[model samples]
Target: MKLLLASSLALATVLGGGASAQTPPTRDPAQIQAGTYAVDPGHTQVGWRVSHMGFSNYAGGFSDVSGTLDLQPKTPATSKLSIKIPVASVTTTSDKLTGELKGDQWLDAGKFPEMTFVSTKVTPEGKDKAKVAGNLTLHGVTKPVTLDVTLVGAGVNPLNKKVTVGFEATGTLKRSEFGVKTYVPLIGDDLHLTIAGAFERQD
Candidate 1:
């Protein structure tokens, strides 16, 4: 029993030492490096929320996202962003409801397989925040929208050893404006979007 306890203690010390050596990300914008970055689809996600009959807010998300970010830390206004999301990748708690959302009555994913956004203007709000105005194309309709974005972190990924940056953005839009006026008031016309974006620098 004493030998076993010594081995366990040695293992714990090694693990604790390794964890303590791991570097954390920096929040300062000055530490960010300017470069073109490709979306890390495995770490990126877009989530949405809508009201359900005035009782609860229904939540869902989309995976398999692809995007590019041309970052210009020196001239923040010159930064550009583009993102594409597969409509068929939408997910919800209920598989049945998820299927229904992709059907003709709702998003009509079969007819419109993807939604995209291209940033036209990037206005810096402060040191680590920005207002991104872009054209959003969804369900064969295009509309201008603006999202308030904040920098999450900038650091070298411990596993990949690549420099990465992350951001979170929030925006709201009316579904009816995008020609998705299905159940209008009852199902909620306003849709709120939250995006968690992760981009890795490319050579």
Candidate 2:
């Protein structure tokens, strides 16, 4: 339908960002300083992949996603995330396709304009990995989804001198679950999602 579980791994990445900031001494979530972090509006995105018949795969993504991360330093496993993804931001490299996505048979952005994901639990897998589970709401239906998350990096941005955290998350979802079953088994019932973004320290 549309993308952005952009809130997707926020559950995944929310597991963990300042200036005059020194380089990140350690990549460990616990080692890194903890505080509330803001998801970078411009640097974050939700990538979607679906099958285009048996011949090929069609891929696209959503942009302009925004979110917040509340990280618990000592217990990184308790971190929480909230993210918002607007249906209007979907892009598929084709104006016609993009239009179809926003129409009634697909996303129906006019009525339900936003898709959201809010983390309910974050379980640490190891030093840099975690399993984040959350409720995903799309097209007016809500479902539980889990993501596999890995911390990509954590450091101070040299240009801004602020602490930042980066993460990569992957998950699978069924577009039909949300009521956007425009194309059934032919197009694809499952959609693989990739969410990558950086969160900036607020405190």
As for candidate 2, its clashing pairs are 5-8, 9-12, 17-201, 18-162, 18-163, 19-161, 19-162
C-alpha-based local distance difference test score of model 2: 0.85
Error of 2 at 117 (Å): 0.5
Worst 10 residues of 1 by lDDT: 22-31
Give per-residue lDDT, candidate 1, residue 164.
97
The alpha-carbon lDDT assigned to residue 202 of candidate 1 equals 96
| lDDT tens digits, residue span 25-125, model 1 | 98787788999999999999999999999999999999999999999877889999999999999999999999998999888999999999999999999
Identify the candidate with maximal TM-score.
Answer: 1
- Error of model 2, residue 188, in angstroms: 0.3
Error of 2 at 103 (Å): 0.7
How well does candidate 2 score on lDDT at residue 24? 48
